[model samples]
Target: MKLNLTPLFAALLLAGCASVGSVDPAPLPLAPGAYKTTAANDATALTASWWQSFADPVLDELVGRAMAANTSVQAAANRLAQARAVLGSAEASRLPQVGVAAGAGRAADPGARAITRYSAGLDLAYELDLGGRLLHERNASALDVQAREQLLADARLLVQANVARSYLALRALDAEREIVAGTVAAYGETLSLTEKRARAGDVADLDVARVQAELAANEAEALALERRRLELETALAVLLGEAASSFRLVPATWATALPAVPAGLPSELLQRRPDLAAARSQLQAAKARVGVAQAAWWPSLALTAQGGGASSELSNLLRSGASTWGIGLLAALPIFDGGRREAGVQAARAQLDGSAIAFREQFLLALKEVEDQLGALTLLRAQGEANARAVSAASQALRLSDTRYRNGLVSQLELLDARRSELANRRAALQVRSAQYQTTVGLIRALGGGWATGA
Candidate 1:
């Protein structure tokens, strides 16, 4: 039996066109603010651009160069541009497309009617978004643009952090080099004094030999420290997008203390971190994609219009009598596609699920980073204090040993040992200070300290 299917198709299309209210995912709950590992009061204020807290002009310059010339930052900017272009294309799809055509021709046929036609007119075509498919696509594209923008922001912040860390490392190496050089000089002097005493028969030859060995060891250490400093400078130069061979970082000896880091609640991280923002945008885009996929199960309607003129004479082509115009609507309904539409809907839902999970992961990682930095900073501070005390005690012991050797109250061996101990303590203290400063910088970066949304 033959059956009319137009009504059935129309009813299915109408049902598919029904609005699907947006699904709102629950906000993830964060831990309370009262969790504290130490008794020290937490600093409450966090800066978005925390690198400036160091007040180092050189560091500021390096960060600027990286932001401008770093290859990674450039790549991120390019991606953002691409995403915006895609968004513009999607928006344009929602508007009617128009075009103009003009042509001239002469034809002669041996048989029938030999006709020459000339036509000029504007043509228009518009897709009716009957089921909001185009709207969903446009919204998804816009969200993608926002996601790319946030990604670029995150990349810039990462580059800034890299430059700052590299600069800190170079400065720390410089400090270590100074410590090694001073120790070498002190060892050289001790060796010279032992030689003079040996010559005057006030000390044994073994005493002079031991002091000479200690001096040589210190010289080797000094050479190693200088080599490390050169390596660190090269690394810093590369981060600033400069040729390592052509670049030289002038060492700035700023012994300023590390700035205090502000520790807010874990919930604050969701608002401050760029990665989290990007993740949320990605989720929104995925959510919109689900609507776009669901809309595919419905029919699409399009309105098209065309007008033109044709005549043997060019003059007659402009006359309304010779003109032809027509307007029509086209509709398409997917009948049987071997379950492609259903598969698409399933894929879109899966993607939305993945995006949601990814957003939660980013949020949790941000929280973990803040906590790790906080604990590191706390331990580094305590270590710095203990190192300072050790340095002072070693300094006094070295001084006493030097006096005793000169008064013949102790051997050259004793003075050499004390000098070595003092040098080691000095180096260790400098290391602790360096670590403390670096950890504090890391904490500030983790807290989203150095960059703002527009900056």
Candidate 2:
């Protein structure tokens, strides 16, 4: 039979009328080229695994463990899987749907003789997608998958950065603990000297009491440092997805070498940051949903076909003479439904607006994070240098004061003051170093694990 092509052609022509209103989404604004603060020798491209730049084998191992086992990372992975499954389902909807049906029935009216019927059939159906509703839905689902993938990346970066920061903090605490222990020991020696001088009538007994009090204070400070260290160790264990009670990290010296990161142009950050990527993906998905909603306002067309055999006897169901078949074209247009379809369109558009705003907000947040970290690192470096000088001078003063006290040229209190000053200076220096490392990790995380351009 010759097909009627005129109606099909007319439907195709009117398909464009069903499209929802759309706005061309523009890219978010970015800051001008170059960051306000970037260190010398730091103009290198960011890498995917930025943590490896630290060159510490132990840290590398810890970060790897966290990436593989951290609960947050695992959760993000699961979400990505879910998004992929949804995308698959949406894509499958775009193709024809086929199903099978089989049935046997027996019925009787009043005392009439019973009759039986048996049937088996294959049913096929497909939406025409003239308005692109299914297409838009599939596209939205695909964008969701991409967004989830980006989220997984962001989660991994956060977990690694957290582990690094915790580890560095523990190391800093270890150094401070050693300083406090030394201070306690030195105070003990001073107390011993004060006691001897008191017995020899060279110093008053009150001097000996003051020395004992200072010794006790240093011991208490040492205990506090140990407590802080334990807390950091426990936190690190959790980040590594291990039982804190069963985990222990032995004290090790902090590495002097830190990876220098170049803050690339703010425009490059749009591609480098996983969070930004995720935001953009969500925006795309929202835009697709608006199209899907707009498509709903138009009539839907579906083609259905069924073929089957029916017979009163099950054995005769497949017989050639018992065959039955039918084909249908269904078109449904909602004249009115209390404005449900219009409401859906409005809601989708509202969501699109919100997503657009969110994308911009994420961009701003990414820029702020990079700037904050860079500024902090620059100041910390200067502070670290000043702290090193203070430590050196304090050490020299402590040595001279010790000699003077032994020669009876300085009071025991003066000797204790010098010793405390030197310890304080050393601990301060260690803290500055720790901050530098922590800030560097923060910067890396902010840059989305050093995502290189075009990655």
C-alpha RMSD values across all candidates: 9.9, 9.1
What total of clashing residue pairs does each candidate reach? 8, 0
Model 1 ranges with Cα > 4 A deviation = 1-33, 38-48, 105-114, 199-209, 263-266, 450-455
Overall lDDT per candidate, in order of appearance: 0.74, 0.80
lDDT of 2: 0.80
Q: Over 4 Å off in model 2, which ranges?
A: 1-30, 42-46, 109-111, 263-270, 451-455
Q: By TM-score, how accurate is candidate 1?
A: 0.87
Q: Kindly list the per-residue Cα lDDT of model 1 for residues 82-121, writing each as its tens digit.
A: 9999999999999999999899876776776667778787
Estimate TM-scores for all models: 0.87, 0.91
Clashing pairs in 2: none
> Model 1's lDDT to the true fold?
0.74
| CA lDDT, candidate 2, residue 269 | 42
**lDDT by residue for model 2 over 316-405, one digit each (tens)?**
899998999999999999898998988999899888778767866776677688779888988998999999999999999999998998
Q: For residue 2, what is the lDDT in candidate 2?
A: 20
